[model samples]
Target: MNLTLASGAPRPSQTFRTVFPVLALCWLAVFFDGMDVNIYGAVMPHMLDDSGLGLTPASAGTIGSWTTFGMLIGALTAGNLTDWLGRRLMLVASVTLFSVGSAVCAVAGGVALFGFGRFVSGLGLGGLMPLCLAMVMEFAPPRRAALTTGLLMTSYHFGGMAATGLGLTLAQAAGWRWVFWAGVLPAVIAVPLLLKLLPESPGVLLARGEREKADAV
Candidate 1:
């Protein structure tokens, strides 16, 4: 069956199921990206108070700049790498990079190490958004592509709010390190599902001359 309406647009129900694996996984990844990005801000007050770390206002700003610099580098490089590597692998790698970065932050004892962790996480955070955007757009129903993109973008805000909630609750309770530990959840939770369920991009496959594989997807 065509599984579409008279206008030749796929029904929302059908379209959703067809793309759900990719869309859902991408949404989850982007959500983590947002959370990781904002978590620093959320935990800043607590971090400043921790005298052992020696975090000053000037140094904090410098670390923030390092993160943004890393993000800029990551964003610029990801597109080139994606062309050679494909979206699925790149997305997985990006998630792993950020999660590992979070772990580093969780264990960091000083300003230098913490700043490095943020920079590392920033690389993955920068790379992830474009990849997720590309994946969802590729899989979304034609007529509803804009809506799907909008929906995917909203997850970032939700993730940010979640970070704030965690800052208020978790950071206040267990400590800021534990909150960053929570940032590692995406690697543990989403990675296995993404590897098993997410399909490779058909367009990328075709571009790489895997026409049969592309067709199968």
Candidate 2:
């Protein structure tokens, strides 16, 4: 079905063909976002047990706050950056930032370093969800926008569950650091796919007066 804007120009309603690629990629990114976010909580107990890291309950809480603070900063800035950088770059950067942050956490020798890592990851985590939601909404059928958003959010929970499962198995077997290493997987897995397959947002193209590019998208 074609939709008509207020200008009476017909806008193409994206079918599953166009929608699925964006949806799947966005979903996978969100899944990793969720996994990375929850992995901290899942492995917190083990972190506290490890004496060398010096993670006390009070410091742990403070580190968590740092993560939240970084998230606030990232969330506030990401939308503005999206206008200039576009969704694909933002997504790629966000994932890479978090993955690199996770690697930092994996190697962190002390509390300060670990907290800094969490904060860095928080920035990426905050940016990723909104970018993904916006991307998916742009491509979804108008009538199905809410449904697609709902579907995208489900990956987050699944990812959290996966984090829990990893905490249960990998943390116990290898160590908490290994769980953080696992957090790096999203960048390794999603970045290549997103760069290859995800289309640029047509709305963004149009906003930039690149109507021909927008139409191609």
Candidate 3:
């Protein structure tokens, strides 16, 4: 069956063909977002056990707070940036930032460095959800928007599960640093696909008054 937009203009079949690919890309990005978000908790015990890092309860709490603070800053800024950067590019940058942050943590020699790494990761994490939801809304069928959203959210839990499995299997044998190293994998896997395949949201282009570009999208 053909799906029609409320606008009753373009044929929905053509639209949905584009929509599904975009949805898949967004879902994968969000999946990594979830994985990175929960990976810290999954590996926290091991982090505390590592003597070189010096993770006391007070300092751990402080490190976690720095992550949250960075998130607050990122979240506040990302929406504004979206107008200029476009959602797809912004998502790419967010992923790259967090992946680099995780790499920093993986190699960090001191508390201050690790804390800064987590803060950087948090900033990237904060921007991801809002950008993803907005893009998903733009791509999903009107009647199925809420249902599609619910479906998209399940990827996050699946991501958390993958992080847990990685922690269980790899943390003790390879070390906590390996887990953070694993965090870097998302950039390797996701960024290339995003840049090569995922089309920018037409809504964003139209909003910027680039009607020709919007139609091309």
**TM agreement with the true structure for every prediction:** 0.93, 0.94, 0.93
Candidate 2, residues 110-146: lDDT per residue as tens digits?
9999999999999999999999999999888777899
Q: In candidate 1, which residue pairs get closer than 3 Å at backbone N, Cα or C atoms, i.e. clash? A: none
In the range 1-217, model 1's lDDT, one tens digit per residue, is 1147888766778667867778889998899999989999999899999999989999999999988988888899999998899999889988988898899999999999999999999899889999999999888877778888998999999999999999999999998999999999989987887788888888899999999988677
Number of colliding residue pairs in each model: 0, 0, 0
lDDT of 1 at 116: 96
Best by lDDT: 2
lDDT for model 2: 0.92
**Candidate 3, run of 10 with poorest lDDT:** 1-10
Candidates in descending TM-score order: 2, 1, 3
The digit string of per-residue lDDT tens for model 3 on 1-217 reads 1345678666767767866877788889889988988888888889899999999888988988898898899899999999999998999999998999999999999899999999999999999888888888887877678887887888899999989988888998899999999999879999999999977878788898989988776
